[model samples]
Target: MLSLIYARSLDYCIGKAGQVPWHLPDEFAHFKRTTRHHVVIMGRRTYEDHDTLLPDRVNIVVTTALAYRAAEGVLLAHSFEEALALARGADREIFVVGGVRLFERSFPLAQRVYETVVHTTVPDGDTFVPRFDFSGFRQEILERHPTDSRHAFSFEVSSYERVE
Candidate 1:
């Protein structure tokens, strides 16, 4: 099935200066645990931002630049369609975890969405998560994390499944 995952602030900010601005360890761990062993598709910047290929999953990096080079194990798809084509070969959930454009493009095709809402506003955000219409989906709260020393912002994880 096709899915997408992302965390955004109250103002819908996902990235600031090319990186996620929050330091929520629990949310990060939840992301890792959820997407593990599944196919993850991301934009070139998102893939490159990571130090290495995401272990234990098929990684497809979508890039408009035809000449772009990624790590040996990482597959490159020149278009979003190509990326989805490559991800379909795997019999696991295809998660688009990415920069803004990828999320916007994949929103319509997603059967599910794992969204983390961080209860804080990002004043200097450069990237924002695209607004999505959730009327067709049912939301279930998966988990909620309170603010603590390790995490500066309180957050809640919710799973939205399209109601057929």
Candidate 2:
């Protein structure tokens, strides 16, 4: 199955430019534990921003550039289809993590979404999660937490499963 995973602020902003503000240690831990042997697909920009490829998982970086060299532990693809093809026979879930463009391109193929909704607004942002019509999915709020006074924010961990 394919899943889309992200942590977004209350205003629905996933990132300012290309950075996610909240430090999601719990979320990362969950991802690492659950998808240890799975494939994780992301945009080239996301890979660049992260600077290093993740170990113990197949890192697929998607880009449209004619030519580029992949870093260690990264497999490069020019499109979402190509990325999926590379992981076609994998037995574990394929997770699509972001940068917005990659998210949009991969959303339709997602069978589920694991989202951490931060309960605060970020006044300035250049990136967003695409609006999705949830008619075909079932949503469950898994957990919620209030931000410490220093950060002045709160958030919920929600999961969405496709109805079919």
Candidate 3:
């Protein structure tokens, strides 16, 4: 299965100054649990921002530069199609965990999307998650967590499957 896992704000902002502006450990944990042991494809920036190989999962970094070499256990792909091809061989859930470009490119091809809709917005971000119409997706609310001292914003983890 091809899945896109991400967290975005009310206005679809996903990043601020090349990074996620919020620090919600629960949401991060949810991300890890969802994509664990899967093939994760991400843009070079997102991979770099992560600063390490995601454990227990195949990390595929998409970059245009021919000289780009990732760390050990990381695969390099020049295009989104190439990444998907590599991921298909894994025979596991393929998760697109990205910067803006990768998410935009893979949205159409994804069979499922696990998204955390943060109940706030960051107007300064240059990276935004593309708006997806839920009409074509069967939406299910997996869980909703209220904000606390650790979590600054209230959010819900929603599962969306393509209605085919």
Candidate 4:
């Protein structure tokens, strides 16, 4: 199964100028726990912004540049379809880790969405996870944490499963 995992603010903002808008250790830890053993597909920008490949997962980068080459152990694809094809037959869920473009294209292809919704907003954010209509999916709140010194905003880890 392909699951799109991400964190977004209440305004649907996911990034600001190529970086996550805030520092939230708890959310980062949650993301690590959820996607550690899975395949992660990201766009070229996301791959570049991360600087290093996430440890313990097969990292797949979708890029259109012919001359693009990533670090060792990272697979590169020219399209979202190709990325998914490369991940085919994996026993575990493949996570569509993002940049806005990747998520926009892969959202329809995902069976599940694991989203952490922050209780704040980023007015200057240029990146976003597209607004979704949750009618076709059953939503569940998996985890919720209040704001603390380490976590600026309260957030909820919500999962949406496509209703069969």
Candidate 5:
């Protein structure tokens, strides 16, 4: 199955200065747990922004840079189609991890989406997730996490499955 995962604010803000704007450990944990052992496809910028390649998963970084070099064990694709092809070869669930362009390209082909809605906004955010057509999917709220000492924001994790 092809799935997209992301946590965005009320205004669809996902990042600021190439990093997630808020620190919500629970949300991060949820993301880690869900995408672990799967094939994750992300754009070059998102791949670079992350401190290290996501562990225990097949990481495919989509980029147009022909000379771009990545760490060992990381796969590089020149386009979203190429990334999807590589992920499909792994025979595991495919998850589009981030960077707006990749999401925009993969959204229509995704069978499911795991979205965490953070109850706040980031006016200064420079990166945002693609706005999807939610009406075509059946929504289900999987978890609702509240603000705690370790988490600064309250968010709800929801699953969306394509109706057809």
Candidate 6:
């Protein structure tokens, strides 16, 4: 099963253009630590924005076209199915990360979601979180931290698991 992880502002917005404003070191560290040996899937745009091959993780980039060449430590797939195929033998959980179009396409296949809700809004955002109907899922508040000197807003780390 697929899993998603992302952070959204209070207004449910994830990015303004193609970037997240806040520093999410803690979140990144947690992800790296937990999914070090897993395959992480993301859209071409998300891969371009980050531009680095993460150590100890398999980076899979999904695109509609095969024009782009895969980097030394990265793999390219023309579709989600192909990406999953490339990750078939991996024994770790597959983590689907951002770029809204990718999230929309992959959400239904996701068994769980880890989200950080930032208690603030970006009035001029162009990207947003998917509207999830959580009727069949159980949500747990994993952690809540008040924003202080490092960030302008407080946020909560939450985990959602599908009941069925």
Give the per-residue lDDT of model 1 (tens digit) for 50-129. 74789999999988898988888989899899989989887788999988899999999989999999999999899999
Residue 90 miss distance in model 3 (angstroms):
1.5
Q: Per-residue lDDT of 45-96 in model 6, one digit per residue for the tens?
A: 7887778887788899988876887578898888888887887656668988
Task: List lDDT for all candidates, in order.
Answer: 0.91, 0.79, 0.89, 0.89, 0.92, 0.81
* TM-score winner between candidates 2 and 4: 4
Model 1 deviation from native, Cα RMSD in Å: 1.0
lDDT of 6 at 148: 70
TM-score of each: 0.96, 0.88, 0.96, 0.95, 0.97, 0.91
Clashes of 2: 0
Cα lDDT over the full model 5: 0.92
Q: Per-candidate RMSD vs. true structure?
A: 1.0, 2.1, 1.1, 1.2, 0.9, 1.6
Span of 10 residues, lowest total lDDT, candidate 3: 126-135
lDDT of 4 by residue, 1-164 (tens): 98899999999999888889989999999999999988999988888887687899989999999789888898989998888888885666799989887888888878999999999999999998999777899999998899988887999999999996
Poorly placed runs, candidate 4 (over 4 Å): 89-91
Residue 143, model 6, lDDT = 81
Model 3 CA lDDT for position 65: 92
Q: For model 2, what is the error of residue 127's alpha carbon versus the real structure, in angstroms, after optimal superposition?
A: 0.7
- lDDT per residue as tens, model 2, 49-147: 776878889888888986877787688889888888887766667999887877888788888998878777788976788876667999999877766
Model 6 regions more than 4 Å off: none
Assess candidate 3 and give its TM-score to the true structure.
0.96
**Local error of candidate 3 at residue 30 (angstroms):** 0.5
- Cα lDDT, model 2, residue 25: 67
